[model samples]
Target: MKTAAAAGEAEFYLEPMIVTAARYDNSAGKPGYYKVDEKKLENGNYDNALDVIKQLPGVTLMARGASGGMNAYSKILLNGSDRYLVIIDGVRSNWNGSSYNDFDFSVLPAGMLESVEVLSSAAGSVYGNAAKGGVIRITTKKAVEGVKTSINLETGSYGREQENILHLGKSGEWSWSVYARKSIMGDYSSARQSIPSYENVENAGIKLTKAWGETADLTLSYSVFSGRYKSKIFNYKNTEPDETKPPKLFKNIFMTDARKTEDNLTLEYERKFSDTENNIVGIYRRSSNAAYDRSLNVERPWLLDLRTEGFFDRYSKQWHPKHTLTGGVEYYKDQVLDYQDLAAKYSDGTVISKAVHLQDSWQLADSVKAVGSLRQDWNSYAGSKLSPALSLEY
Candidate 1:
């Protein structure tokens, strides 16, 4: 009863590459973790992290300002909100002073990143409040065994240009890497003939590592980013124009010109005490200063300068053949060095945050695993909270 076409259809099968699932053995104990590696970065032709994130599913991109213009402020939304946390090499980078705990991705240069990891599911139980939606972790390249250097130059339409340089080297027990990048984009006007918008960004970073015996290692890293942009804001009338007539006149309101600079320094130490036990400690400090100048709204120009310092210690132990236990504690302090307007200055009291977390992973069966986590966080501004989670995987 089988015809020729029917017989061929019975033998059809999917390709091996199409059916095989990619494995992630280095996910740092995160579930549903997806990573974009250097090879994928090369293929994506991405100029920044925001560009790369746009290709990922379940991530919504929100923009403010001109449509498709370089001066736009882009934000990422996961789990239907922008509550996700951004971490750079295990250090929280978001500004806690802001009502919404969000980090600006546009200021970071993609050229300095070695990989990007996204945890699609809720990670609040593990990472704390800012991770109620998800978590994005960015890792930078480390020095290799030998010297490696590269320089890249790119140019395109609309007077867009970018330059990047990277250097990595290792000598004796010391390894170091340095990266620098700059990008500039010319003005572009909207359909309303609003004033054109432009953007310029520069970033530099350095990492140093030292091997201390066979069981321990130390790493130090620092990065600085600066950006300036101009954009026009439009105001529209509520009343609708005549149906047969042309669109109503939209008044050009304020023209905003803004500048921001941020810097981060981190030091980390890792030690493998035994085959089944390891410990890590890290300290980091980040500072950001920004100025917003709006024409026509000259009554008040805004300035903000804030600094945050934090440290974390974590320990992992494989107590049983089928069970692993991990615990960590983190402490951070935030200070508003300057918050000023054209008329008066305001002082924001210091904010402190502390957290302790514990997690256990147990293999229940050959294909079944269980995970449980508990975390307590105390923030000067947000109060204290205890979060717990349990999950099973097969």
Candidate 2:
């Protein structure tokens, strides 16, 4: 008889493990954090991050069209609307500099991720406005102790094909890793066979880490992604239906040919003062350029540039034999440059945001704990706002 581990490996070709922090835990007391590792990602036939996120609890994947096209938009919803924030390797992945504040998961490839953490509660006090709903954090694979390289290829119906390559190694005080992937799909008929749609995506990323002595570590990472999609538009009102056949839809005034490119760079430095004390500083820059071509043959372009820098300091100490105290402070600055109107060039503007937050956790008793957080934010458009949160668990 096959053991549980053997069965899981044979089915998914990866190990199976899940770690969760519930709201009613005794130690740490932090709640609603769930981790999904690489093995869980391979359990399903997932191509993109959205596909894997759909399987998570308390999440709903909503989409409209059968064909994945530029016109179709999908979102991951928690208890409410899709207002969640996405962070990759501690950097905000959502393109807040653009008109659309929501993060698009379709373009995020699943092959590059080593793990995903979902915090299914309001974290506004700690993460600012973007975390009003929740937060989804992604971590990429790190360099292995030994040199290793792997390649993967997959093909499916609708002429879909994908290829990926990854390499990682560690030597002395330096570690490095790189990954790349490309996917393409042939044109396919839409729901009513009224339109044909297709999409192509390519992405690559690299990370380099260096240890400065035993107390300090530094990491630099960069990633680039580009995608293009074409789809036809239909008129819902102008439809013809027959008794034995599906409805015939009228072609709209415009079809869509859209393209987008994103670039992200991040640098992080960390120092450990003690076993329970640490400090971190990070800086990141992201830019996105998008173009849309309508059936009229007119092209419209958009550009979004964003830069963020932040620092955090945390310490944990035991006040008594049975009581523990943890405290931390964080500060960050976000700047966004957006080009709104192209023809007139009059809608160009910049938004600056600065925030600082402090949090403390206290263990009151053997089964009781209290967590408190306070934050202050200053925005160019919205002025200032204060957020506070307090939670008690027993």
Candidate 3:
């Protein structure tokens, strides 16, 4: 019998694998990464994406005001820190460059998400300065071989109602997916203050992909979310004569109205040179607008309008027997179009950033693996910095 080497073929055939759990889908696998797939999302019946994100280990959810839902304040703490990067369909979604602002989840439909991956470890080395705490990646559903559609309608206590629709199909060399969702939260009394609040949200997204020869593909996607809320709060007031008798305080109800809208557009191209090599290039733009009206409490209404645009490229190659190398470049510009508050009108300006990163994964032994990454970033406003990270798994 002839030896397999005599056949003049590669020793082992490359088998494609679908990985939705790892930190980098095509890069080295890291520990402490968790993935919530479509099956889990449906079986859990979560109200929103945030609810599903809360179930992950090392993650804590905190909210204020209207139970952290729409029109309220909510944030996620990963590994004891609230600073983290959020990526939706390969596009950055941070309204504020610093990640300290409230992250609105009302627009993310649980039924439309294909998977949510969380890397709880500090990953600045590969994701840049914004990923000090970790990274949260959300992947929307996409068409496969055939067409599929789903509809979800739900009602809950406090007069909450939600509806979601998803349509996905693949025909010839083109694939497409569309999603729409609406949520209405009726007046509900807060547990602490018994304040009544109402909220409504609307969200929609569409993705289209065109493939050529199974080696290259182009994808375009767009998403929009709008949400508004109204709530009444009691303010205390004291009269001159009231100070004489126990300082009688009068309660005044003030109505507050807040609205927010976000939009994202992205275009990406990917080419596969082989099973072990590939490259991706993409461009994206994201914007968010927020307005708050509280005439009774403040003299002027508050508003914030922010927009960001960026480009990114990444290449992955396996050049050695035990090594896989990945390199990437990123450039982004963040601008505050309009900003105003009770104190003053915050200056409107723009901040730009350019960064490059390299990663190496080594299969040290049969049961041992190591991954190391380094990133250099230059920010127009904050100067430059270098970040490095290393991990070993057995």
Give the alpha-carbon lDDT of every model.
0.74, 0.64, 0.76
How should the candidates be ordered by TM-score, best one leading?
3, 1, 2
lDDT for each residue of candidate 3 in 237-306, tens digit (9 for 90 to 100): 6654754577756787677788878888999999999988999899999888877765668567767788
Q: Give stretches of model 3 more than 4 Å off.
A: 1-30, 64-73, 99-102, 120-122, 190-194, 231-255, 319-322, 363-369
Estimated TM-score per prediction? 0.78, 0.74, 0.80
Compose the digit string of candidate 1's lDDT tens values, residues 251-293: 6476678787889999999899998999989999998777776
RMSD of each: 9.3, 10.8, 9.8
1 or 2, which is superior by TM-score? 1
Model 3 lDDT-worst window of ten: 64-73
For residues 48-98, what per-residue lDDT tens digits would candidate 2 score against the true structure?
A: 777766776667776532222323346557656566778777666774433
